[model samples]
Target: MTKHFKSAFRQEVAELVVDKGYSIREAAEAMGVGKSTVDKWARNLRKERNGEETHDTPISEERRRISALEREVQQLKMEKEIFKKGHSSLDVGLNEKFALIEEMKGSYPIKSLCDAFEIHRSSYRYWEESSKKIRPEDLRTDIEVKAAHELSGGSAGSRTIATLVTSGGYDLSRYRASKSMKRQGLVSCQPPKHNYKPANKANITIKNNLNREFSPISPNQVWCGDVTYLWVGDRWRYLATVLDLYSRKIVGFALSNSPDSALTKKALSNAFKARGKPTGLMFHSDQGCHYTSLLFRQLIWKYQIKQSMSRRGNCWDNAPMERFFRSLKTENMPKNGYKNEALANDSVRDYIYRYYNSVRPHSHNLGLSPNEKEGFYWKASNWLARKG
Candidate 1:
């Protein structure tokens, strides 16, 4: 090793020379070495006992020298083990334990050793599976990870398996999970559910180009648009609305005898021609046929505006509209069907223009009146419509 470690052993010889009361020549003979070695140590011991420093000092760092000296001091005691009056510091039995672990194949878990050694499970597997490659070292660890995944119902992702490996004391990042699992031919077994509806927004050429993400600082920043069906007399009547989610208010709406592109366009036109559309605004709605229809689709584009559609087949995608429908069914819809068209029409108006906006204590709108919440998001998104 370093010169200081060797010099430390020499220092021990100097001490021995004085303790044994031997002259340089006699000690040199006992040590089976030259007289010069004993003479130098003799001179060094005299200088040290006289509190004088040697000129030929070691050049290593002081800590290295100190550690070497401490190790030498411990070794001096170990030289006189058992039956000697001097103390013995060596654990004498340590090598036996090391040899046992190194030789026995399975007494200790391979996985445990792998973790202790911080070796990869994949490396262990590669060796185990090949007669040419089987590493006697890694076979146990590689098998355990695979077993853990199967035992965990295949629901366990790589992260869980990594945690299992860590419990054995070896740490590994989950980055290797996919690679390891792929080699094992493990596939998560689950049948896929079929959904029939098409996503109109899937075509990039015709997709929603306007990303209408907005923060409503005031009531009219962005408006949510949607249409729901209601039974009036013998036919289907549709109610279209423009809602401000901020206050949960139905600002502009139309009562129509038909569910058509015209119905939805009328609702938007009324909101824009009346209150003025906000600038840089977002208009979100479900992907109902009317909302995605070419006619209404052009209307939105003609205005040079942004449009957002709920992901296809995702009903909760338009949560604000979902809440509006719940309110209508619970509070305004007829117990069975409307007694007649005229009666349903009138009741729908009163609820939308008056009770729903003015009296409903919408839990999600933070208990505030829709009119009170509207101005905040409207002004915040800076979507003030300049045109009718």
Candidate 2:
């Protein structure tokens, strides 16, 4: 536009001087420009060829610079995309982010891009390999988790859902399952705490043989019992339960109008019968008259079951029992209390047998339901016996 030569002409002149074997002086004379102007043009052409600046560099380098500029712009675009997407790496996950880096591999240096995005190369490599090796069962994990949540009465936590999905033949981890559950707006109901009332002291008490050793290796080895009250038809109805220490399942239960030795003994008798009168079992409870009564002691001796009592006033000694009652009340109790003892008893039966045993997940049981854990143990035991 100015007095300077056009880009096409400059390029041709430079090519004539360098590539076509014409001297700068002769080219300048032939082109009818001053020697100094030709010299300047020649010097600029040389600089451009040497990847240096030129007097006409801005205009002259346009063609050569476009490709590099375009690449730089693309890199800036990719970086901007990374920043936007990196808002929640957990949401996008390492596998997808790694894939994005792989896709832009040629355009930008991998390490540089990863650093810019705060991604570790080692993790990306690991994710790349793992993602490529995903199996059929690995798919639809989120769906399986959602199904598990629904199966848990919309109250299963992420860890419980993970166990449920695994039990259903889907491979999943708790973290991933939690993320999936969060994405699906699945929330587990928070468990309520149990309040303990001091056991009613009677005339006699026994030694704390169980000694708060709640963890037992097998079901029926140790059973903890407790009594709780529920409101029904304007009267207090008592619920007594025996829980297997190993699985925390309500092995036996009895509902009555009175919290007496008869009610406690009835629960013990039910457990003894249902468990096939298993021997060498320990029964643990607080120092209540219902548990420490002469009649209950005689029954324990009849079955030759070891009697274990909690320390005089400590409730944590039989914590699982308390926790069970709390869960029963919090999760199973009717919103407006039962209309009658019959309804209350039926609700207890439904909770212990149908829901708590078979459906509700127990944290101590590794997210397995009481019945499921005990079933697994029995199955494994039988299998081992047969193999042996």
Candidate 3:
């Protein structure tokens, strides 16, 4: 009696040795075939895979080339379909690509599609099983939410993330943002709240002249000043800023190793010179020793500017300045601080002049940046002056 086998069965058995790592003897033992028979099958399969003609394969040169061309055309067609549907394979997530593969599986081979998308077959199979419970729209929204969160340096909360997603043309709400964040285990980075304690009263008497009136009528009418400490070069450095309350703009700033009357005076002097020494200006600040010192008071009198002091230990009296510092520390400044004074100065300068003044949206300015608000005010003032 002679043994017989189908071509498909023979090819599959031979693949155990050729495509898989089985030896000829091992494959023959496993499949209950003769060792010589297994060797011949493996040889023929190798030749076929390499497009070479064999006695049993019997494929002509032209036929082999035509088959190769046909396979190339099929691959191109599949790639074109993927690009048409997904735009770019790299732009989508692995699970999303697997979903696409499932959608087009009837049109093309699953293994070929997985290979084209650069995804492993095992990963696709796993995703196929797990993706059944997840909606495609939810997956897309999660991706958008993650992207928006990263773009905000992980500082955006649910509301801000929702706004960012909407700006990117996605219809995401705060609820969805929160849900996605929870699903992705993403938590926004937030600065710690400070516990301010009551301090001694000011040595010199200056009433709350601005009296918590934050919004001024015009530029140079009222300016507020404050000092904050930054860690640089393994020590504390001080930053003093003068803000025009009308536009919430940092008109002047100074950085120094000392937090004294000189630092505050220099900041104020810079603001006065920058604003062309406008008269009848009121400068408001907290009752810190730097602001109440005799040296600082002498400079205030020299500039002939009115001084207003916040109520002792009351931060809300100078709330705008406090808010500005909070934004700077939370949004821009590095948590571990800068490596050197020069780097710190540069970072502060860019944050003040570029991002804070020109780009960041301010609620007080009705979402306009500081520079934009000031520009609008100047434009209106000029128009009114010209009309008069």
Which one wins on lDDT?
A: 3
For model 3, what is the error of residue 217's alpha carbon versus the real structure, in angstroms, after optimal superposition?
1.8
lDDT of each: 0.62, 0.79, 0.84
Selected candidate, larger lDDT, 1 vs 2: 2
Q: What is the Cα-based TM-score of model 2? A: 0.57
Predicted candidate 3 versus true structure: per-residue lDDT over 1-388, tens digit per residue = 9987776678778889977899999999999999999999888777777867675632234444666797799889878886676666457776568778888898888888888888899998887786557788889989998997776556667876776677568899889899799878888775677777745454257988898899889999999999999989899999999999999999999999999999999999899999999998999999889998999999999999999998888787888999889878876678898899999999899888876787655778875778989999999999999999
Using TM-score as the yardstick, the better of models 1 and 3 is 3
Residue 47 of model 1 has an lDDT of 67
The C-alpha stretches of model 1 lying farther than 4 A from their native spots are 1-215, 375-388
Clashing pairs in 3: none
Q: For all candidates, what are the clash counts?
A: 25, 0, 0
lDDT of 2 by residue, 1-388 (tens): 4476676777677667777888878888888766776667667777766778543444255645765697679878877766655563435655557766777677677876687657898887887687566455444876798788766556668877887777777778899898787556788774755466665342244777887788899998999999999989898899899999999988899989999999999999998999999988999998888987889989999999988888777888888998888677766676578899888888789878987898777889887889999999999999999999
- Poorly placed runs, candidate 2 (over 4 Å): 1-147, 176-186, 192-204
What's the residue-level lDDT of 139 in candidate 2?
47
> Looking at candidate 3, what is the lDDT of residue 376?
92
lDDT at 281, model 3: 93
* Candidate 3 worst ten-residue window by lDDT: 55-64
